[model samples]
Target: MSRRTPYFFLLPAIVFLAWFMVVPALQIFYYSFLNYSVFSASTFVGMENYRRLFADVNFWWTLLNSFLFILVTPVLMFLSLVLALCVRNLQRGTKLFRTFYFLPVITPIVIAGIIWRWIFAEDTGIANYFLSLLSIPNVHWLTEYPTTIISIMLVTIWRGAGYYMMIFLAGLALIPKEVEEASLIDGATIFQQTFHILIPLLKPTLIFIFVISSTAAIKIFTEIYIMIPGAPMANKALVSFLYQQAFERFDLGYGSAVGVVLFLITLSFSYVNIKLIEQRG
Candidate 1:
């Protein structure tokens, strides 16, 4: 293909990205250097925004949350792989199973938020109700600090793992039958075959899942927003905290600064991930 052909094909995306993404991102960067409120005039403030962000206790927690979210990827990956294997091995109604697995992925986030909110409701929720079944007292899943984060993580894993599983299912299905047969002929156990053969071959899929899930975790918002309003979980994610500062607290300037920092951190993360993957490849 000619060099111009690729650009021609990409021209529309490039135009849309420049207008919507690049321009707005650059504007955020510009605003990060200003003391601009949502309603008031923005004054040039140099790097004061960044400085304040470093000193803000809540911002530090939010940053820590971002790292924790990234760290959750391995668990997510393991869950997805197990799910993909189970679904792949099903003999009857494979399509039905696939659809069931993908249902959460395609479900509206609003609906997920509503469902999880009900499930973890402080007093009337099913989770606590079930805990009460085991003679355990009702614990406020969404209100308690440490438990709140864990609850959100649990929800995150439940809502997201299936989507990654579908991706993994596709990758698993792509493996040549002969490869598995050869491994079987060599008397490899299921674990050995999967670990020594399948996983190495599935590296590309794993990498895709890792990067995408890590980014998704880092940008988590709506789940926390809908489920843990006015509670500790509100501060569980940097993006959510950024939203609080920007919209709720009406510190648009500071919020913009937070956004800028999040953008930088996320970009740096993706860049490093790509570089490491390239080196390994």
Candidate 2:
């Protein structure tokens, strides 16, 4: 009955969030404290799951992998920004180019992973086939430790950068044209205008992209699951390993614990990013 009716309109979404996101997350935490099994009923187990997690070498490897992915965000940010700038400066076909670039972001991850697996194959894959014509030996891309990680990282960058580029392009477009004109009138070099004007104004968009990309990077599973598949000596990311433990091994407790740890690490980074963005603003 009141003029503040939008609050009532939003109530259903709030309820849905609580029912789905909030409740499932709390259940994951509770299950992490239990001895859960796919083949049997769960029993209370205190922090044993978490203790086992801390002592596991694979867990540490995954943690390191997660951090390594965070490092990728800056590289992606630069690529996205560069592409956005290029598109912004273009006078023709910008829409067509944007659609082509962002197609991977919308493609199903399973399909993308499968396609990449073939391309990365050592001998017969198109990538190595062409390389061999130039006399480069076929590289075992997915069977090696660091190389496997590197291959996954490369694919991740290719698949993700365009979406962020679009986001950045939108942010860049919203900047007042007169501000840029003023900079040009004052004889600001392109580098000076970008570093001093564009970046500072895009801080909010940057923070949003960072949080989204960092979280998505940590949860990387589809590619590793499709490509690596327990290849001996290859260090898979933590999420893929957790999938093996939970669904493959039926060790639900440990898997849920790993998920909890991943969530906490992501949350910490998101919080720090928010604070840094606020300070800069």
> Against the true structure, whose lDDT is highest?
2
lDDT of 2: 0.86
Query: Which lDDT tens digits does candidate 1 get at residues 1-281?
Result: 88789899999999999999999988988888888776888899898988988888888888887777777789989999998888777898878877776788888877888898899897899998999899999887888776777777887787788889989988998999999999999999989998999999898789888888888888988877788777663357899888888888787778888888888877977897788689776
Q: Estimate each model's TM-score.
A: 0.90, 0.91
Pairs that collide, model 2? none
Worst 10 residues of 1 by lDDT: 227-236
For candidate 2, the clash count comes to 0
Which residue segments of model 2 deviate by more than 4 Å?
1-15, 232-234
How does model 2 score by TM-score? Answer: 0.91
* Candidate 2 local lDDT, 1-281, one digit each (tens): 89779889999999999999999989988889989897888899999999998998888887787677767788898999999988998999999999999899898888888899999988679989988989999888878777888888888888988999999998998999999989989999999999999998898889888888888888888877788886642277878768878988899998999989888988897788878877875
**Full-model lDDT for every candidate:** 0.84, 0.86
